[model samples]
Every structure is written in structure tokens, then in C-alpha cells.
Target: MSMREVDPPRPSPARVYDYLLGGRHNSKVDRDAAERVMRLWPVRELALANRRFLIAAVRRLTREFGVRQFIDIGSGLPTEQNVHQVAAPDSRVLYVDNDALVVAEGGNLLDGRQAGYIEGDLRDPHRIITHPETSRLIDPTVPTALMIIGMMHYITDADDPAGIIRDLMVHLAPGSFLVVSTATDTLPDEMRQAIDMYYRNPAAPLVWRSRETVERFFDGLEPVSPGLTAVEKWTDSEAAAGPWLVIAGMARKP
Candidate 1:
């Protein structure tokens, strides 16, 4: 009898993140990836902290800036307090990612009832910006909060992440906002190396940037108070000073 081929299920980085947030949508493959990151970054707190930043940023955008529309690119599995969940009571959100597992699992979790999900790459902003389905939720003429959390590193100078950001920002109105975060190297090099190695196992590895490199993503935007800073420090009443591998900030299109 011929043996059946067993193709490894290479779960998405998004699914791995879902595991870290205590969601059940992740596969064993994703679990392995999360474990690798938790071990390498040497600061398990970074993951938790990053989530907290997302919450705070969203709240401020909704309550303070009156942003009722969102396009959360690279949103992982539908973990508790997802962007639509947090912003939904009032805001309409459209999530975009190309991971099949993420679309399948998140579909099961959200049931496509609350906010819409589209399987597309953020690198392809033109399609996302102009897609008819997305147009239903996000009107380019209105203000929106574009959440690009923890996904920029996957894109490089060759991919033009900075340019991607600029194009998206130009389409938003003055009140529209952008909350972005990426891995940094303020922590020990060993920690960064280990954390990156986890993603390195896949077809492509993540490339962490320096603070200045990340700041470039917000070049033309009017920065919110506290400016671009560490993830745990962006607009925090009492910022925690630590050598973490993540940096974050919020800015307006002006």
C-alpha cells in the first residue's frame, strides 16, 4: 500500500499569537512557534504588554478622537477583546490577513456576524483600500483607525512597509489615526535573536528595526503626545522603563 503524504501544517504567525493570548484556535504548529518566541524574547511580559497597548490605544481613539471605523490589518485569531469586540459597541471594523488558518479559525470564533474579515495581505493595500467588501465598512472619505500591530517586520525595505503606511494614511481624513508597533532590539541581542529565530523557521523571518527606522513609518503624520516610544511607554500615565523588544506609537494623518 502507498503511504499517504503528511504535509506539515505550518500554522500562521497570527495563530501562534492567538495561543499566547490564551485562545483555542491555534494548532500544535502554532503552539510550537509561540513557545519559541516566549523563550527567545526573554520577556514574556512583552506579549502581554503589547496587547495592553492595543487596548489603550483603541479606547483613546474611540472615546477621544471619535473614530467609529477601523481596519485592523494583521489581526490574529479572534481572541478576547479583539479590535471589533472592543471598538464594536460603537465602531465598525474590517480585519485583513491572508492566513488561511486565521480566516478559518477566526470565522469559527466570530461567525462573521460582528465585523467582516478578509483574507488579503497588507502589502497589497491598494486591493484592501479599494475592495468593495471593505468599502462597505470603511469609507475612505471618513476617519478610521488603521491598526498595524506586530506585522510590519514581515515587510522590509524591498516590500516598502513605510510606503505602505504612507499610502494608507493619505487615504484617511484628518481625524483618522494609525497605531503601529514592531519588535525592537533594546533588549539583549540574544533575546532578539532567539525571538526572531522562532519566525525564521518559516519561509520568511521577521526583521526587527531600530527606533529611528520604525519612526519613519510615521514620517508625515502628526504624532500623539509622548511621540513614538517603547510599547509600554506610549501614552502611559506611568511608563515602565525596561529593555523590551517592542516599540509602539500613535499618530494622526493631519
Candidate 2:
């Protein structure tokens, strides 16, 4: 699949996110939807902060933890400094997204690269874990980093997000890592209005959680340093003042 195969008429969260990140894979509809959200809040800044956190997390995992494989669930359209690009050349990355448009665009962008993209939803952890592409690229016996950045908020409580995380963790090695970031309910009224605008779109709905609830997802895993802080504050590189809309954390399976 390629950029030409992307569904331009339908606005997807991934495409809108790509637009927010200043990537070229988004359509006019995506740009319009992104603009609507940005008008109500600093969504562009938040998204950039999230991206920076992802890069920092990847570098830390690869350089410090010596992790060599990554499974980026809900990875949107590939942009500059992707997971594979940030990790060592020997590292293997499997990018997964529920959006077909994202899969197509990512496939095109990752062509000739060692990374692989697969179309899969987060709700079904087994399907993604057992998929041929995933199995072939990732070794379950070795420590792997499972990244769920900026996407878990879409999984409503009804979907049992904690259960989903536990299910996926069961398949990983004991030393594997879980990296995640999700929107918190602790937002200003204006940002709450922006979330409302996001709900108006047909894309995946959000289920904002509090800091406590988000931390629950890391149950049984040991949190890394400076546990569960704002995305910009996760590392020293991009620290800044904030109405910190989202919380991020990384934990290791013990």
C-alpha cells in the first residue's frame, strides 16, 4: 500500500494526528479537523510534546536498557524520527495501527527499511501478537518495548483497557518494557472543549482518565525514573510549564 491508496474522504484520528505533527500524509479533511481541535486548545504543542517524549523514550530504551525490538501499537503515519529510525540499526520495529490509511502510508514510508507495518486494532492483543509479521520480526523470549503512546485514551473503560495491557504483557518476556501516554481528565475547560470537538468526528472516541487510573495500567510493572509525569517532563530535554493534558510513563516487567 502507498500514499495513493489512503482514504482521503474519511477523516481518521491517525491522519489528523499526522497533520498535527506537520506531516504531509494527511488530507484536507484531516487538516480541517486538526485545525478545529487546535483552535480550542494547544493540541499542536501537545502533539509535538508527545512526539518528543516518544523519541526520548525510544532512545532511553535502546541506549540505556539495551532493548533491540519494539512493538508500537497505534503508531500513526510515519514522520521524521520514527521508532526504527531512533533505535539502533540492528533493532527491529513492528508498527501497528487500526487505521488502514495509516498502514498504507506507513508501509510506503517504511519501504526498503527494516521496519514493518501491520493493520491491527488495539482491542485484540492476541491477533496482533500472533500475526505473522509480528512473530517474524519480534522474539517473544527477548526483552521488547511495547509502546502505546497517545492512543490508549481511545479505549473506553467498557473495552477493559487494563485487561488489554495485561493480556499483551503476558506474551512478552519478563524484562520487557511498557511505554504509554494518555490524556488525563485534569484539563482546563478550554482543553475539555477541544476534547468535545474531537468527539464530534467519526474517528475513535476518547476516554480520558485521571492520573490514578492511568497509573493502574502499569500494575505489576516497576515504573522507571520520574514515574508518570507529563510528556514534556518525562525527560530533561523539553521540560516546560504546562496545563499538562496528558500523562506518560514507562515500566519494566519484573
Q: Rate the local accuracy (lDDT) of all candidates.
A: 0.76, 0.86
lDDT of 2 by residue, 62-105 (tens): 99999999999999876767798899889999999987767877
lDDT of model 1 at position 168: 84
How do the predictions measure up, each by TM-score?
Answer: 0.88, 0.93
In candidate 1, stretches whose alpha carbon ends up further than 4 angstroms from where it belongs are 1-8, 111-114, 201-203, 241-244
Q: Candidate 1 residues 1-254, lDDT tens each?
A: 11112113774667667677777666677788778777666444666778888888888888888888998998886576788777747578888888765765565566444478888888888988888768777777889999998777787678888899888888887878999988875667787676666566465567778888888898878899776777878646587655646888999987
- Best TM-score goes to which candidate? 2
lDDT of 1: 0.76
